[model samples]
Target: MNNAVTLKGRTEGFQIILHASASFEEVVDQLKELTVQLKKDTQKGHELIFFVDTGNRLLSADEKKQISDIIEDEHFKISSYESDVISIEDAQKRAREARPKLEVRTVRSGQILEADGDLLLIGQVHPGGTVRATGSIFVIGELKGIAHAGFEGNENAIVLANFKYNAQVRIGGNVHVIENRDENLVQSEDIQFVYVNDLHIIEVGSLHYLKTIRPEIGKHSGGLF
Candidate 1:
């Protein structure tokens, strides 16, 4: 009964936590109040996607629909309530393993760099070097080697590089080999990235269009990137 429904904002989005002991009716009422407050907040441009968490409770389909109906409105969308947050210890371990940064001068042939989370490289990948990650991979320098992102089956992960040559890039299970091109075809500082499109094919494009195609990665929602 205490704090039956709680709403918390995160950098990526918001989280709505429902207490396990609360009755369905109570939860629905709290959701209504939350949405009303959210409406007011939206007027100030404080809009964000939100995920629901039914702590220690498995909601029935009808109950879920009812909850969704209560929260269905502009500026508020329900992501899901099925997955629970990981334990603090597990989170810490993930944070350590997926520290999000790995800087090296140059990745030589046979050299490999991998990450469980986003990987940021400040140097170049030589012709035979390799980089693999479960999340997005960002290379600030030239990339002429192999780059594989979404290694853990995340189709949304992307591979970005400041200078592109003939590199083998893979996003999820899709792969694309950038053929050697005339250097004059692109600007000296041109940046490019590879990703999986709606048709499930790997495509190469400019970084400027990344946000347009994959907003979730830009926003870091659901640890998507």
Candidate 2:
């Protein structure tokens, strides 16, 4: 297969490295074979997540999907993609999306709101409502509905909301249901950050220490984090 694909274990997790300067078809073929071998070695009913690292190669969205299609299996999931190259045009677009957006209206029942990057919502998210962002979510009002961050597979994204009411938070592919109803948990007192942990489970931590947890979150995001 010309070493088109190499699977390696990283300190953070496992990654499937795609060789640069190789034919796309060759890479695809190797990916398929590697995934099959991975499945054979995996325990029954077990799942594995892999980050695709395309060294010196910038892949189009369709090409990314093609790789995903090859590695997809009952036990295999493509967590995210790492590319060493990006066109100037794409970089500019990403720069624009990196800015946090603001929403002032309340999210009513059955309403769904989405943002390409970080979202700074100034209104409440009621039950039966939903909010999703490719980055993080910073709500100025009560978040009683569902909030999903890193909806596009960036696990580092987070959701900031009061934990005094019931809600659902999703970070990447991990989900956590919040049922806290204690009145003591008010804004500024019980605001929590929801995110996917190292264990790939959705978890929450106190906002008081958010700086220690994700200090860099304010970078290029307009401090919305």
Candidate 3:
């Protein structure tokens, strides 16, 4: 019973380890006992964040809900659940989602181009056309149309284009209309990127600044510059 549920303190946070070989009922019973003891030892009105580690055990939705319901303390919150196993289909799907989708055709007027993950376009987006991505969007040609990044509510997503002097850019819930900018500077051949700043406002900066924002964007590519 002692081995059914174990609690350990780590630098990241407190961890509640569920025994891989223990029966669900036994684990629940031991967890209940430990929670009662912890409640008594802890000071009043203190919040506790715990990471639930299911070592080598995959829990169903109902099972996870059951454990959550059992830990019914207002001051106790479960930050996340960690499992050691993933299905092959899930792994494959993640791989696909991680890879950026690339297209080489112009997005004509009235057309809407979208990607599940990042989108890399080598053609221009005519006015009245729209390009949307669940992740980031990189345009090598003129972007005179609407560019919506993080369409799935990913605030960290960005938009990159050679020049977007007169276009609409959106990241998550924020939007920025590219207009009245220095036509000479913004119309340059060098790449410029658009992102959401700390204050949640849209910002357009040089390509070099992208490394500081998302270093991983250069993973498959040669370099950020």
Candidate 4:
């Protein structure tokens, strides 16, 4: 009998269990092989589930990068099958309520701000300034400090900024740091915020709702003419 990868779908999330006999290297090899197969047969659709044993520590950065690449590739869409899953309607409602509205300017040292909708920063957030929100964060200037989105446990929050030289970023508690600055994220006035699969924070293109939410910015109260 040929050993096959097993995937279990549950209400909460999905679980993938690799056969006990499969080694880490073998699993990786199989993933590559599957990638090829998926490419060959576009209609079949590529599906995979990765089960990580508690005893095994996932420490290989390269392997992780490869796996991430595979999952993020345009050709594949991975879904989680788990026991306790939230319905689509419930998820959307939660996302809207949990989405915060953040507005700030030059978050100084030792300042902590939290929002339940979206975050809009008019100026820079200095180092040591901490801001967290449940929805999205928009910084008009640079983000050279610590910021977190989805702090209330919602992962759909995004962080957008005019510049991306942040010291640290946490999306749903998943932290990312700027080890080095590049042109794509340096001195660029154009920045945006979005969530990855409603799971992680990402840079996107404009948060249009800000105008509607903050009507005072462009509102013209008419005087007796």
RMSD of each: 10.7, 9.9, 4.8, 15.8
Candidate 4 lDDT by residue in tens digits, 92-201? 65565443354646788899877655666677778899878775566777787877877876665566664446467777767767533564544434564444443344
What lDDT score belongs to each candidate, Candidate 1 first?
A: 0.79, 0.84, 0.86, 0.57
TM per model?
A: 0.55, 0.56, 0.69, 0.41
Q: Backbone collision count in every prediction?
A: 0, 0, 0, 25
Best first by TM-score, ranked: 3, 2, 1, 4
Candidate of highest lDDT: 3
Q: Which candidate leads in TM-score?
A: 3
Which of the predicted structures, 1 or 2, would earn the higher TM-score when compared with the native?
Answer: 2
lDDT of 1 by residue, 11-36 (tens): 76888888888887788888898788
Write down the lDDT that model 3 would get.
Answer: 0.86
Model 4 residue 69 CA deviation (Å) reads: 51
lDDT digits (tens) for residues 1-225 of candidate 2: 379999999776689899997889999988888878877898988877889999999898999989888887767788899988878987765875679888999998899999988899999999999999999999988898999999999998999987667888888888887775655544345677887777888777887777877777877844322
In terms of lDDT, model 1 sits at: 0.79
lDDT of 3 by residue, 197-217 (tens): 889999878887789887777
lDDT score of residue 76 within candidate 4: 56
